[model samples]
Target: MNYRQEVEALQPQLIEDIKALCAINSVYDANTVAENRPFGKGCRKALDAMLALGRADGFVTHDVDGYAGDIEIGDGEEGICILGHLDVVPVQAENWQSPPFVPEIREGKLYGRGTSDDKGPLLAAYHAAKLFYRKHPDCRKKIRVIFGCNEERGSSCVRYYFEKMPACRMGFTPDAEFPVIYGEKGTCSIVVRGNYRGGKLLALHGGTVANVVPQQCSAELLGEPAEYEESLNKFLTAHPEIRAELKGQQTHTCLVMYGQAAHASTPHLGVNAVAAMAAYLEKVCPGPISALIHRKLTDYTGAQLGIQAEGQLGALTMNLGIAKYDGCKLELTLDLRIPHEVEADALAEAVRMQVAEYGAVLEYQAGRALILDRESKLIQVLDAAYREIEPEGGEPQAIGGGTYAKAATNCAAFGPAFPEEDTHIHDSNEYISLTSLEKATAIYYRAIEMLMAD
Candidate 1:
């Protein structure tokens, strides 16, 4: 089958679907909760519209409560599943020339929330399913398009659905980079909480989400702030890009630090405001928190803490996304992506030791990380589909972004993120080019077709 040709024919329709989804303000809003479903009314409404769209196309769609749902195409027997999420990261309209939610097209790129992270890929998968059904009306394997709504916050949506649905033989999540992902590092969120012992710092704050590298930090301090003002000023001069301030003309002031925000998965690519605050704070106010920064927060490349954790998949890294310390107490949350081969308990022990010095406690949870064998049919088939477009001959690599692939049987992250091309997913001005979208649809079509066969 000329899947690429079929994908080309559906390009206009694909773009229309993405625009329609993006226009719905589908970001997870907390206020839209009357029933405890986290994402607000608009996001839920957008999800419902997506399910409705699938049903309108003559497919059997199922809504697993309001958390997530799936659209089944083709009849009987297990087949390949195409997993994608409906939830999107919050948008900042001020950063873009056009509104972030409105999804404007300038210079051939679709600008909006979920365009690159998910909605674009979701539409591409839907068209691939549609093309599959159209081309092989009597196909043997059934195809399912899973729609998850709480992927960004937590995958509670899909977790609930999996409890009541049939298992997919193999699948791919179109939520990450292309050339496909062979391994996804283990994800663990560690938060250290303790008392500060002193009574000077008050109401420390930074970061909106645990997964986003905070671009700003603020802490209210007491006592002779002027004593440290000179040193703080020197520190600020060295890092001119950031905004640091000791608010007001009085000794009681709030120190604020600013940096560029980006996702925790790839921390090296972002400017972590939280880490900077801790680094300078450690030097200015030498203590457990600063020690934590030197040992853990400062290294996104995982070069320190004697945890240069690496494997055939990739090296582990930490993103100090959120921090709070009032001279009397402190709390730090770190997002870690570890190789599958590494033991979670062992790593947790290492972290436990670090926080133990200050009587601080650590809390951790393991997010799923699937490593599809390179020799497996699933990887081989997926590789063929990607090679058809980019013939650079690079093997599928590992990633830190968590996806639905780890939710069930044999699956890996495929497409939406082309190799070596960073569109800055989970950051401001997130977008997917028209060319990339088309290539993704073509790849998904071929992959779905090939993997569904006996």
Candidate 2:
């Protein structure tokens, strides 16, 4: 069918669809939540836009009460699903060069909030399905492209959809890197809350979401501004990866630190502002909160808490994603990606024991990890399609980022982000290369065709 040629012919329409979806700020908003719009108005709008596009292309579309939607092609009792999300993380507008919601193309890259993460890749997969259906009208298997609205905060959208609907026999989500993703690490989020007494730390705040490494943290302390500024400068001189600023009066001062932001799944790629701030505060406060921060939470490996594990898939990583300290109480939101070999309950217990010494309690939620056999039909088919295009591509690999694949059965994360390219999924100025998007469309088209062939 010459899938690459068909994709090239439809590239313009595919890019326009991606831009239309990316224009909506789909971050979940409880304030704007309504009956069908469980996530928010923006997410609902994104879902509707995708469905409308499907209908325009003469495909059967279904909206699952705004939590999720799907476009179906062909006819069959069982179908193959292409799962993707429309929701994106909150953005710091000041950090971006261009408006985050407004899609822009510069140096052959599309820049926007969800461009690299899922929106662009989702549209690419959707268009690939459309092209396949156009070329093969008598295909045996059906193709269902599922658009989810709550993948950023949690996969509540798909959870609701699956409760009302049944899972597909097999599928792939265009949310991760190329080649293929045969294994994904287990994911867990832990919140530690406690009260502390007798410390110079009065109030501290950082981070916007649990999946992103915080870029900035600000703390109010009971100290002279000049003294704090001197101490901060000394600290920066020793550890120059972060930047610090001091403000306010002599008696009470606010200290702000800036660090690099990356996905929580790969905390080593980022310099966490919360961790850096806590390190500095430990020297000044000498309290339980500071001690916990400096001792257990600062390291990305969770070595001090004795929860580190290296399995066949990968090592267990940790990110102190969010931290806030009010006058008397402190709360920390931690994101951990664990390998399948480790037990989530045991890891939580280890962390809980460490935090108990500081009079803190831990709340943990664990997510399932996807581990598929390398010789399975789904992985073999997707991997064959990928290698067909790039003969030198590596074998299917594992990842730490959680996707809708974990929410659905017999599904895995495939393509959109290539091996050598960094799409900046959860960071400022996220973008996707035009060439890569087109190539991914071709790969998805081939995969869908191969799966549906009689």
Against the reference, the lDDT scores of all candidates come to 0.79, 0.89
For candidate 1, what is the lDDT? 0.79
- Cα lDDT tens digits, model 2, 1-454, are 3667778999998888889999999998889999999998999899889999889878799999999999987787556899999999988887898999999999999999999888999999988887887888777678888989999888999999999887878999999998899999999899999988666888989999999999999999897888776677889998999988888886899888999889999999999999898889877667788789889898889898989899978999999989988888889999999999899999999999999998999999998888999999899999999999988999899999899988898898998888888888789999999999989999998888877763
Q: Which tens-of-lDDT digit does each residue in 31-58 have in candidate 1?
A: 6775635567866887788888988988
As for candidate 1, its clashing pairs are: 32-40, 177-417, 178-417, 196-328, 196-329, 201-327
Question: What range of 10 consecutive residues in model 1 has the weakest lDDT sum?
Answer: 89-98
Candidate 1 residue spans exceeding 4 A from truth:
1-5, 29-31, 34-42, 92-97, 197-200, 223-233, 244-251, 283-288, 301-303, 326-328
Candidate 1: residue 361 lDDT (0-100) = 86
